[model samples]
Target: MRHSDVLVVGAGMAGLMAAVTAAKSGASVSVLSEGAGVISIGSGAVDFLGYVNGKKITDNPFNHLSELGEMHPYNIIGAENIKNAFASLVEISNANGYEIKMNEEGLNHTAISIAGTTKPTYICSESNNASRILKAKKILFAGVEYLKDSQPALAVKQAKQYKIFADAEINSALLKSPFGKTHRVLNCLDLARYVDKEEGFNWLKSELSKAAAGYDAVIIPPICGTINYTKHFKELQNLGFILVEAVSIPPGVGGYRLRHALINEAKKLNVKFIENCNVQRAVIENGKCKSVIALHNNIAGALETEYTADNFIIATGGIIGNGIASTPDKVYETIFNITIDSPVSVEERSDKNVFGSHLFARFGVKVNSKLQALDSKGSPLYDNVFFAGNTIAGYDFPTEKSGYGVACSTGYTAALSALASK
Candidate 1:
């Protein structure tokens, strides 16, 4: 029987920003998530698209929405609001001790020239943010096995040119066996077992202990333990170290880092968090929601927990993260069970084309100007339930560098709207 002024579901960028905004505005916020927030698999830059009328080559958030609408018209609407969303994002980033930048060249959308492939690699120059951390003597890279393998070594080498000590190490303690012996299991996350094994964990400890000798901080992917991201950071800090988490690409499992960062920061803010608490369903009476039924788990296993709130932000994320629903047959929403405005013609292409060599993968939920989840009719699902980040739909941010920018923007906007309503 717990209650708060606002209840944020999901810990992704949108959800995190929403909760932070509400909490900062003097609202008691409770964030419920099944796992860590997404974004840990990224370059950690606030990506805004296009230029802002300067030689600096900045991006205009509004233009991003237009570009996205053009690319995936069926899924998203209200292109301009997306831009405004980012305007608010600037405030949040500054408050959080991170600098936000806009690229004028829009080079982030173009193919970066990689050695072997004629196609340029997809990269957002979060150089400014990355540069700040370069001051650190060392950076630790930890995550799922295949995740680290995705990038070409040259990419890491280039980052090193910028003066970053990138050390890639596997945490055997986090490795886990894919349920039942199946070949497909290899494709999934097996690193859980690696981290769990005594020998494996010991090996990592010995290696980190040795590296800890002189390094200033360790940059790790999301290696969340026991569902508490803040706890993991606390333990790491207790060991006397600073942890910088990068973004996680989808299906690749880099999202763990994104989730962990939110968890870590949320704790510092003293925000309340509840995990494994599924929203059985929401009771939206009238235009506002009154309460939600959440399923909780403990040593005794799953139990139903009802939570009441005055405001809410649903940032479950889009298709990639399971916030928006899709399958081999159809696509739709999972939480509110609303009909999604899917594309008229589905792109039935090979897996090779679908995933793409670039990070700007266009797949997931769609949103309108207000950052509200939309139905097949292209209307808002619930005014109170503001959407954010990858789930907002439209734009392929990885390539556009709009992901972080749009996310930060939409997150800020949603919070602003929520606060305004309050």
Candidate 2:
């Protein structure tokens, strides 16, 4: 049996943030995860809220929180807590050698994607700062030959369509394949590993200097080193070129770098991380969660391990992350088997339009302002148990573009609430 003051389930941004926050406040924290969360698949930039009332773009996302319904996670987290959460995340990133920069006015900035689509994000990697990219009069879209995901020519054509960059000259350039002919299809992971080495950096510098000549800023694939992205950014800056990293595709190396930094910071705070443990059930006693039973894999066979904690936080993520499971007529919280508040019938969940609202995306465990999990009747399930991240659903992530921000804010708030519990 393992015991801790705080036990957090999941290793995604929310779970990691909760563990780090609790541990820093002098609570003994243990984190268990089935696998790495959605970070690797997400764009590295932190999106607060990009759209409101459907596809309407708002300059200041924070200003429109009041417009959201009562069930929205941002409203439940409150504005002050959201600010504090971002501050804590920035501090953690800086301490771990990965600096994140946000606008001074707390407004969202436009981040250019590899496909040249502009996305509204609150905080972005210093290397991908939009302000620097916007200042350039001439921009060079650079790609590696044989790169599977990034297309320089296509990006240049798409970027030219946007009126925001009309004044800047958009050009395309292709450098030699960073990985040579070893692999037929070069992925972002390969590029990231290549850039981490000194020889690879030198090769890239030489190639970029030639391809990016006469251009004020060079937008390139996010090949920044996974562990030392900031270091690579500085080294590239020393080559006398203004560099901007494009928002990545799935298996995002930049996101992986951010995740690695968070995990390293958590370790510094003495947070115990237990990977490959799938929590199966929670033991409730006297209206409180006493412990959880997890399935652990070993050479012999699967083993059941009991972990007892004074308090527990569920950051297990949403349907996409498999924190909540759904069927034709039912939605369920996996660990506690709590009934999710969703449509009663399958017909109510189905939408005829392909890009229409998905009821399942909004199905998750409900939590109150204190971050405590609530039953269908709005009652706390366990006094010592709380929920954070995608588990506490109220908003659609794709439409709102508030998923990462909500995760960070709710995770931070959940930690504070858990630490104050009796």
Candidate 3:
């Protein structure tokens, strides 16, 4: 049996944030996850409502919160809490030596995407800013020998189409893969790990130093060091070259770095992480959650373990994350077996266009302003059970580009509410 003041059932952005926030509030926190969350597969930049009604948002995203539905996670968390949450995230990232910069005017800043398009994002790493990339007098787009996914030419083409770096001379160069002759094919994660080491850093420095002399900034694949990217970024800049990481493909190295940094900060605050543990069910007693049972498989067989906590948070994510399971007839929350707050019929959810709005996108447990899970009658289900992130109803993450912002804000609010509960 394991005991904690707060038990977070997912290790994604929301869960990790909740753990850190609760721990900072002087609670003993433990996080359990079956695998790494969507952060690793996401763009490292934090997007806060890039598009509203098919229109691009260039100003402060918070100003458009009123446009969101009443049940949207941001509305539930409120603007003040969302602002504080971003402040906390910035503080944490800065303390870890990675400076996440936002516009002083509080507007969304443009960032270069993997496809070379300019996308709006709220908070971005200092090295990944499109505004900085545009300011360079001359730009060099460098590609690794065997890493074929990132196309320098396409990136340049897209940048020209978007009028980004229009004033700068853009050049492309193909450099030796960091893996050398040992590995014919290089994965982005492997490249990131290699760059994170001292030997690999020296090799990269040697290679880039050869081609980086004339250019004001070097645009390369997001292969900066996995865990030590800030150090690498600073050291590379000290070599008289501004480093810019191109938007990454799936399993993005930048996203992995962000996730790693957050987890590292959480660990520093004594948040316990239990990996590969699939929480199966919650033990509820008299309208309160007392414990959760998790199952793990080893060489021998399946082992079940119980974790008891004064408060529990379900930040398990949406359908894509397997937080909620769906069928032809109904949808259900994976652990608690709660009926999802969605239209009951499948016929009503069917959409002809694949890219059109998905009925499942809006499927999640309903919650009140306190972040407490609510029943059909809008009554609290469990006094100690709270929900955050994609687990809560409302908001379309993909179309709105509000995933990270909602997760961060709601995660912070959930922690604060749980802490205030008796």
Candidate 4:
């Protein structure tokens, strides 16, 4: 029933940035996302590497793009455009009051500096916003018992080391294995009782009822249902607590909140959203996409929705996020059915330092200079369908903590070009 100039899917960093830029350019845009994991338990910072141009560790955006091609030959082909993407991202962030600073010593993809292992430069957005909202107040870091016991306590201790003032509280909810022994853990948010079950919800209400009035916010560990943050916020709001926001992923609360925020923002801009609207196939006429047929819900309850667009930008995330698929044996884009050119080799799967302490640290989707989705034969799939972010192939951001950085750059640049094409 609705039509837009661009139909962008997924609400991760790339999706959000793409939608925002496209909408601002006066193009009607809509975003659909099944779910996203980037923000929840993700590094809440934009990452970019630095190079030593002279005595200074010059953070040249061009050099960063070039290095990506050298390391992951299939990773980046639009090397010049990639640099422009980063430049656009820097411009946007600087204008938004978030100043991204560069590291001095030829920035490594990943590094362990005094500051909880500093990797590439982190462009902080909500830097002042997060602190401003929590000014001089204490936060209750509600701990999921099993999770704390399972993973290294380094992140928690490191948060304290960074002087992020917060206190930890353990939830009594326990997760056990078949033998009735504790296997993993769940926080108040994760426990079935507190989330979907009525009894647990009541218990959470009664227990947190008092503390809700005292603290600034209740910080929860990334739980299974954390991605539906709007729903979570409603529950918290009903109990008289202001749901500030969550941190970035492994702990998924932040990504959920970030997705919710983007959707809400889009709605405010009069952008239409059709969730569960799965694009089944694209109709191309004369090498340009004419329309896209989508399935809403399922066959019995499904309604076929057709959207005709002048252009399209694919923000679907990479393999790990379901935008693209790559196992030990194969790699391909899921929606458009495009194959990647020279996907990451199995040998480079895990570098000797499994932790990934180098640049282009994570595996990324490979793309040409125009960011077109490429096939296994190294041919461009479609001229109209451009891509951004993790789906591009070759480079890895998780290891580099440059996931957000690359995603933003690629997303911004893609939207700009799509608009120009129009």
Candidate 5:
């Protein structure tokens, strides 16, 4: 059997954070996952808290914790831990040459989405912050013909509707394809990688300079070199226009950069990842998790293998990521086989409204302040196993916009708790 001091399930934001936190704290760490989680496809920003009761929070999010339900992860862990965790994540990113900006007031920063809507984010990468565009007297919406994800005209029309841009001068410009005549559609990741090379950098600077001359700031899809994105953003800003990156949907370049940087740092710490090992069940004994069994196929062929660790962190994502599974009559945690008490019928579980508040959105493995997974009877299921991210839930990330923020904080908290309990 393979072993380590800590075993983190789900190699997404929370899993990676849990593994890194333990390793950095001097624990030998091993991570197992079916595949990398949604970090690469996410908006690549730490959204501490955005909306409460459909109202946008304009000030320090910490001040508004009273509005959140008591069971929310922020309240469970306390505001100070979240702040420290956010700071830790920022420090790690900066050390890896990835710069995320946090303002002094701790208010949410607005960012441009692929659809051209302005949304609140607690902290964002320097390249994607919309403050420059919001302050600019003149703005340009730059789009590339090859990148269908961003439409300059749509952005121009949509972004202006926000009060922040009400008086700003705005226009749209469709630039020529920097990647010569490749008829296939390109996502943000494709263009960002291209900008890593000399040709792509030259094309962007030369073309954008000519197009964005009159505007004080220009918003473009994320095309900064994924590896040296901050340096590229700084170099391009020297061309006179305040360079702002608009985050694209899915296949996200911004998220990919964060994941890339973190994974690189994890590698430096010698964290091990067991690929293709889909964890099916947890081997719990004596009121503690002893090991986990995963099915895998490799040089040894398809078979079941057991992995033991002193502490285990479960970050397997929620319903969206299939960490929680459901059927007509049952709702449950997949690996632990804990049946969740919920509505008996499907209609009672969810609302007909797609974006409307639904009971199922907040369903997850309930945890105590210590972050240990609790059983249906409200007792600790396993002393050594802690749940992080969407796996331990009380709030809905979709409406709260607190996915990565909670994921990071709870993952770090869970890691610390697991180590402390031992």
Candidate 6:
């Protein structure tokens, strides 16, 4: 049996945020994770609201929060609370030396996606946000030669298509491979880990210096060190080079940088982490959760582990994160037996376009403003249980680009709410 004041049931952005927030309040916190949450492959950008009414958010993402349905997480927690939560997260990250920058002028910043296209994000890391690319007279788009995940030409072409880069001079280059000939495939994550080492740092510095002699800023894949990324990013800036890292696809190195910073901060406060923990069910009684049961692999078959906590926070992530499992007929929360009926078939639930709105994306355990999980009647199901992140769904995070923003806000509020109950 394991015990803590708060038991967070996911290790993704929401779960980590909840755990860290609770721990900062001087509560015993333990995070049970089946896998490293979506942050494992997410861009470091903390996307808030990017689009509403099928249009780009020109300034404040919150200015359009009212446009979304009331059930949306933003409405539940309110914009002021969300801003406070986001501020808390920035303070935590800055203390850990990982800075999450927001638009100083209350405008949204455009981050370069792995596809070389621009996406509106409310807050992003220094590397992901273009450092005045639109104002630069000369820009360089470069990629690691041996890394197959990115291409300089493709990125340059896609970037130029945007109206912001219309008049700027953009050049493409594939830097020589430092890895040398190897039968193994190298990716952005691999390069990021390599950059964490001293030798790799020397190689990257030398290569960038040669390639960025006459360029104002250089756009490249996410290859900053997995640890101390700010230190590395700052060092590169000292070389008179403004480095903007394009967001990458899965095996996201940028996300790993954020994850490392977050987890490292949590560990300093003594937050325990249970890796590869698959929670099976919740033990609820008298409208309060006492403990959760998980199935663990053993030498024979499987083992059941009971973890008890004063408060339980469900930040399992959405359908993709496995917080909610879906079948052909229904979508259900993995724990607590909360189910949402999906009468439509796979084809019916899907949109005609790949990037269109998804019915399954919005399927999650409903929660109130306090982040407490609710019954179908819109009543709190448990006094001590709360939902955060995609687990309490309303708006489409991927489409809105509000993933981390909502996760951090809700997760922070949930932790505070739980402590208040105590």
Residue range with the least summed lDDT across 10 consecutive positions in model 2: 177-186
Model 4 alpha-carbon drift over 4 Å, by segment: 50-65, 70-121, 125-184, 188-249, 298-300, 327-329, 342-365, 374-380
Pick the winner on TM-score between candidates 3 and 6. Answer: 6
lDDT of 2 by residue, 213-327 (tens): 7888898888877776788788788666688888888876767877887899999889999988899999998999999999875425877889999999999999977789988
Q: How well does candidate 2 match the true structure in TM-score terms? A: 0.96
lDDT of each: 0.50, 0.84, 0.83, 0.53, 0.85, 0.85
TM-score of each: 0.58, 0.96, 0.93, 0.61, 0.97, 0.97
Candidate 3 overall lDDT versus native:
0.83
As for candidate 5, its clashing pairs are none
lDDT for predicted candidate 6 compared with the true structure? 0.85
Tens digits of lDDT, candidate 3, 1-422: 99999999998888988989999988999999988889877767888789876678867888888888778888888899999999998888778766787778999877776557777888988778777767788888888877867777777787776555668888788778766654455666777789889988887888889989898888887777877888888888887878877777775777777787788889899999998889999999998999999987442587789999999989999887778888877799999999985577776664677766677788888899989988889899999988988888887787788888888888889999889984
Poorest 10 consecutive residues of model 4 by lDDT? Answer: 170-179
Tens-digit lDDT string for candidate 4 (1-422): 55678877767788777777788778898776666546534534455544322121335444445444453422343555545655555554444323333333333322222122223344432321233233435444443445442222343355454333444231222223112225545432344224445554454455556545565554433331333333444565565443333233344333333445555555656666666556666788887777777786635777777787777777778766777766667655777666554336666544576554432234345566667766657687677777877776656555434577668777777787678778
Clashes of 6: 0
**Candidate 6 lDDT by residue in tens digits, 90-176:** 777778777777789877888887668888877778888884576887889998887888888988889888888988899988777
Query: Residue 108 in candidate 6 has what lDDT?
Result: 81
The number of clashing residue pairs in each candidate reads 47, 0, 0, 23, 0, 0
Error of 4 at 175 (Å): 20
Q: Is candidate 3 or candidate 6 better by lDDT?
A: 6
Candidate 2 local Cα displacement, residue 140, angstroms: 1.0
The 10 consecutive residues of candidate 3 with the worst lDDT sum are: 178-187
